[model samples]
Target: MNASRHLLPVLVLLLVTQWAAAQINDTLPAVVEPQVDNNRVKFTSQLRPLRGVAGAPAPFYTYFWEFGDGTYSFEKEPVHLYKDTGDYPVRLWATNNYDDGKKPPTRLKKIKVEKKTMLAANTPPAFFKGGGSLEMITNQMPRPGEDMVLLLGYRNKPGSHTATVSGSVMLLYNEKQFGQNSFDLAEARSYHQEKKIGLDSLLAYAPAEEWNMPLQGTLTGEADSRGGGLFTASGGGNLPIAGKPQLKAFLKEQMEGYRQHHIWRINEVKQGEEQFMFLSLNTLPEMIKDTNAVVTISGLFIPDDPSMDVERFALDLQIVASHDPNRIMLKNRRLNYRFTGKNRENIYKVQFQNTGKGPAKRVAITVTIPGMLNTGTVELVDMKPACTWCDSAYANQSCIDTILTKDSIQFIFKNIYLPGTQQEGISDPDSTMGYVRYKLRFTKKMKKMPFTSRASIVFDKNEPIYTNRSVGRFKKGLSPGIIIGYNTIPGKKPQDILPQNYVLGFTLSEYAAYKKYFQWEIYLEKSRSYESYDGRRIGGDTMINGVGYKVEYRDQYRQQKVLSLEAVPVHFRYNINSYMAAGAGALVGVDVERSVTPVVETWIQRPNGQGLALMKGAYEKQLESFANWRGAFFADFQLGIVRAGPAAGIRFLQYINPSHQRIFLYASWKL
Candidate 1:
């Protein structure tokens, strides 16, 4: 057992050693090489080589190199151009296949290259005291297949009155003609000139033909003439006539062209006489396409007399590229088709020169959409501000204005000038300038419907009249009773019935027992009278009588019940709110019905044989019942909490019947 244990340990140790060896064999040895320096080759157009030596030569090799600029190379010798004249590190490596049993290799090195420097150009171009010039300066010539940009500054001399200067620049390519350009610049301030192009004269000049190039030349006229002698010439402000005939002819031709083409006036003569006119055929030189060229300008002053020598005038010139290759040139630029739809979906396109010196900034377009019947959408293809004003307006619309919608579309160009440069930034001073395009759609619905009736009725009854009649005297009257009335016709007569007139059948009523106490009774009433009036009053006497059975139930500190059969004159009673009431009716039955009265023996009496007299007396007393009927107008004052929905109110009724008036309290719920 002891031997086995020892042998086991020995065997394990051998196994571990073998495994380690296998791992080592699996990984190829790494070869570290020196780093190469890139600076040595930067200034020269040559390839730099880096080398690494392994322990011995091996087959199956590959190479890798890391340039400083995040780039890798696989060549043993790598050639690279330094974007700028500077120093940089270069690295390289060579690897052999693992089967070769040799470590991969790497190497690095530093090198230096020298660059040549060039002189600087800072001198400004030559120009007359009154003229200006512009030029560009750069550190070095552009490299092969590279682009360079330079800014040129220009300024005019103070106190210079020169106006209408023309100039051009010649661009030479490899010392060969590349392009020629020209530009016309107007003076910053007005100057006095005599016998010059006046507004009226210029207005008469016809516009040049569309195909005809614009005149590209300068104009020079004598400044104001100095006052001469003690008495200066009175008409000194006007130009003196010199070479009048030639000027006149030139003016006539210009005027004709202006009238034909409607060219606007450039200026008007204010003072001095015509000194000289430099004119050029606006067409480009034919040689421009063949060779590079320089531009030179000259002027001559014409004397009034042909005998006088023509005076020479100083002039300036500028050269510019007539054509630029970077420009995307297009001819007769125009919009082809446009379509606008709801939700501001709009598309539009135009043909234009893209590569040339377009307007200094992008063109701005606004699509104004008129509100349409169904669609409510507006779109601007590409919108940008081309000029200062255009920029302001565009900014205003984007930031300050609330009327613009988010879905609107806009199209814009970075640098371009449109045909109406002069007119731009003039009108709508607050608006932006530039080429603008717009497409808009508007939609919505609007409608309205509107409509407006009166009703009144007047009841001609004794309501108010009767109520007013019974003001007081309640105790002397019969107990307040419920009065009912019916209509009855006594007779039909032509004179008595102008219109439909009917008599009241009778007024039914009930009176309770206790005097000046709470009592309840029932009664019936009728009226016998008929009258009709047409413009005049017609009246006739009538009788109201009726037989009624009544039960009296009274309670006021005492209880009482009364049953009676009586022939009583039914009285018509008018009861208003509270204040007053009045009634009129006749007694009819023969026997005066009675009810048993409690307490001591009650006495019953018969008529006093004053037949009509008794009737009259009863009528008088019962008339007091009419007092109950007295068109009692009770002005009941109500006092209670007012609220929405149903509410109960207590009112004090102060009423006056025909015989008397009293104040009673009542409560009611308002629905």
Candidate 2:
């Protein structure tokens, strides 16, 4: 028995060696990323493919359209003009081919058209954002291998600069996640919808359904495991499989789905004299096999740095040395597989454990899918039957992403917290281990056959990656789970609530002075701007209606200066938009000069429109003798804080005369 067991590993090794030799890979096909016009509205329109995928062939593409304005265009990008202003719903369906009554991918959105007369105005300080220099510490160019850490350094630029840097790093189609975990991998490997899925399809997983939209993007870099994938356990690191032969056989089978790449948005940067951002890159394990692939990084500022005149910053790096992937080990925590519910209701459950020395931060498990043993397996719900249920006691739904393809789907589980860190690794029950359970559709059609499957795993701690694959046959069955990545139905979706948003600001307004009104007067101003979640933009009060205010100096004829205080009871501002606002309010004040102002005014324009002399002593005596008051009903027109307003009402004893209305029109600056 011992001899037979030992020989099995050797036998498995030989078979894998033979298989790798028989496999073939010559040339990789191109990718297609279609770009159609996505605007609210346009007078003239244009459509084309991005990069160099254009000019392929018209017959290969099929276009469908719904202009919403009772019109349609079958062209790539259709140009249409609307006779009136209204929201128009637009839809476009683009397909490389229309095969077997299949629906193509499409884009849908509403276009807005506006027709209104607008006046141009020069304004400033409505909104603000600033500048800083960003330095990245990564490969000027990088080669495919282990996941890498990127260091971002930022500093404010000279002279009146903003201290933050916000942007994104775009990696195009270069990112490929494992796809179709439940579909028959073994069948997919051998069967083709049309021309056979070449051996290249193994390393390069583009099922027949994806031929219309090939993976055509420039590949800059990828992640890969180094060294043999070690299985870390309480007893110390050991081979995950029973023997080396099994290990070899697993690696060979994994050769089919070897790929790596994970790049997403860069986070926002806070203002400071200097700041650093650390980024962890997720890549494919297959990339390590290639010793000569370079990786690149690209970054562009948010809202765009209109001043730079440059589009983005790019850096690339190359790989140097590699290590054994087996350094950190991850395996089925439990050593078995089982199934329940026959026909379209079979559930498969598998658990993996880490029996190695290192802790893996990211773990990707690719479950092999076998071709339908029974044609009775007709209806396919949510492509990856394995991912139908993403949450269970063993698996956390928050950390999974699944990508589905015609034949296979891959479940990407990330941020795995194992027992180990830079210093030590985890121990018993810490679960250097985890499990996955899923349900796939299958039924015994004619001949009963043993259920079978093959799977591969890729994991790492940013360096010296680890990977392994295993094949299992069902003398039994198993349980299930869901995804951490990919845009497929039955996949995990984002479940987060947005925070409340609103702007709070302060504004001060100083209107007009009194020398010109032949009396002593006061002047001041106010205004501010911001928006709220309710779609309302509230701002500081705007001086509209132009009943302007004026600057009045102490008149030469009157001497004594008055002491007084002002209280404003009502004030309100209206936001027309981001640029304009109108304001109205009522004001009242107590000024020693208020009571004397009408007397001075009466003395100056004596009902005859001629100057009338008044003594300074008489003004002072009367100012102190009676109760003083001032009030106004004002209207203002404002462009920014520069305001123009007109206010009219009574002053001093002038309130005693019902029709005594003196209007002041003025413009002034405010803080």
Candidate 3:
């Protein structure tokens, strides 16, 4: 019974242990609660409440803060100063320890700090009108990058106007800013007043840095009309002015609108003798009427002493027409004239008017005649009535003398003229007809004479010449002539190549009675030759008789060879006056038996050779047939006439083999 009781205790212990293990493995329910607002933390507050768990304790705690001046702070609840004027952020955190036995204890809530509010003073100063100048006072000159406070005082009639007035203060600077405590203004000042403001003090932060000082307030106040006051003071530095000559020149050249009426002059000289100048721009309409003027000071004048720098001072003036009242009239009246003549002596007359509103003075005229004159002489003449003040005369009889006046000026010219020419008779004909040209210019001041007008003229002559000629010959007639010639075949054995023999031919012309050194000819010729080559001697006579026509064009001559297909044993000949010619024709000749025997008997004994020998023999027999057709093509070069009367040439002849489909050289002409 005691053992049984012990066993029950052991069973109960096991059950308890198993239950504990089950409880350890089980998960706790998730907490459902509101979270803390981390952005709502207030300044001066100690602890912040976080959201996400209402009944649960804080799980974790953290802090954060933001100052309006581009800075941040992190703490449960942070306190910080905004070094400058701006907004700031505040944050916080909460810690909580959860007691669930199944999981680890964790801090769960996080909160945010709220943005802080700041107060700003935007009120302006009140203005007062009085006889005395209103003074603005400050504790010290404004530092380079710091704000300054200004005390503005205004005085007026008692109860004459409202005592309270409001305005804004503006800060002007030469540079920009970075953060609240950082800026680029090296020197700064303060200014304030009812009617005027001035630089109170000059504060320098760093020598290399720049500063932006502010003008304080939109100053407002009432002022008595009798005692109204105004004050002026210098800023950190003097205002910029045009001090350099290059800058002045650039301004004068580029600033067209202000150039005409503005004049810059040296008004005074300083202790070092440096000239001080000021610019005066005319604002009146009449001063700049119809004139666009620019004056640039190119140089300066110093007192002329060896020791002093001052000397003769002069400004270069470049005057340009800016506005033209008669622009349309001038554009419409613009004229260009062209004069053409056969000779340089031909007079060219041109008349031109201003056709504009401006007057032309000291006009000049010049004449240039081309040197290509057949006769090497020329003269110029002016055709105007004689005047006492302006008269010019030419000594040459061909030239005329006259005077120039305001109304009109006439120019006359005379000279012997020549032009480029060709060969006298054969190729060209000569003639003389050329051109003259002129131009005029006007000057206000001349080095030799004042208020004079001048003109410039250029004349060139071109004479025409014929480049070719045309002639006529008798149209129809006939003439005959004989030519005796010898022919030799080309290559080693010249004597064996051809029987050295003579050739006789006849020539005919279109005219019979009009025989002269120069003549046109159409002819027919008949010739014969005997030729041989190698050890085989073959002689056959050939006759060539054909009618041909020729035409002489320029330096070149062309002739066509005419042949009748029915004419057998004849070769056609075509000749150009040049050394070379090309021809195509046919030749008919009977093969003549020579003293050499047939060589086919040497190969007749073999079984297959007999058939080959018979075929060769047949070929030889067919080649001997007189009725076989033979075509010839040739290119020939005339070397010279042999022994004077008969012409000879080297000809390359391609004769078609009737039996074998091959080309062979049948003959060649040798002088």
TM values, all candidates: 0.13, 0.17, 0.16
Taking all chains together, the TM-score of candidate 2 against the true structure is: 0.17
Tell me, by lDDT, which candidate is best.
2
Q: Give the per-residue lDDT of model 3 (tens digit) for 1-671.
A: 99999899999999999777656433322221222233232343333222233333223322222222223332233434332332232222111112223221112233333433453422222222222212232211122212222222322224323332221111221111111211122222211221212211111101222222212222122111111111112122212222234223433333332211211112222221111111111122222111112122212111111122111111111111211101100000111111111231322222111111222222222322222211122232222111122334343323322233443343434332222122122111011111122222322211111111223322222121111111111223343344334434345464554432333434342222211212221112222222222232222222225422121111111121212121113333333332333333444332222122222211222243344121122112112222334454444444332211233444454455553222222222221
Q: How many backbone clashes does candidate 1 have?
A: 114
Candidate 3's displacement at residue 585, Å, is 9.9
- Across 1-671, the per-residue lDDT of candidate 2 in tens digits comes to 99999999999999998656433110111222223233223222222322112221112333334455533333333445554566765655333221211123233466666752233321111111123244344211122322333444343334524455333222211312223111111111101111222232322221122111111122212111111011110111122243334423433442333332222232333354443343434343444332322233433221122222112233333322321112111112111222222453443333333434566555665655555423233222221112333444245433566655544556666555543312152212213445454555654431123344545555553322222222222221211111011111122243421111111212343222111111112332121122212122222222225532221212223333344443445656554533345556665655433222222221221234454433232233334632456566555444432222322121211222233443332332231
Candidate 2 off by > 4 Å: 1-344, 355-358, 373-398, 421-425, 443-447, 461-671
Best by TM-score: 2
lDDT of each: 0.25, 0.33, 0.25
Residue 468 local lDDT, model 2:
25
Off by over 4 Å in 3: 1-396, 399-492, 497-502, 506-630, 639-648, 657-671
What ranking of all candidate models by lDDT puts the best one first? 2, 1, 3
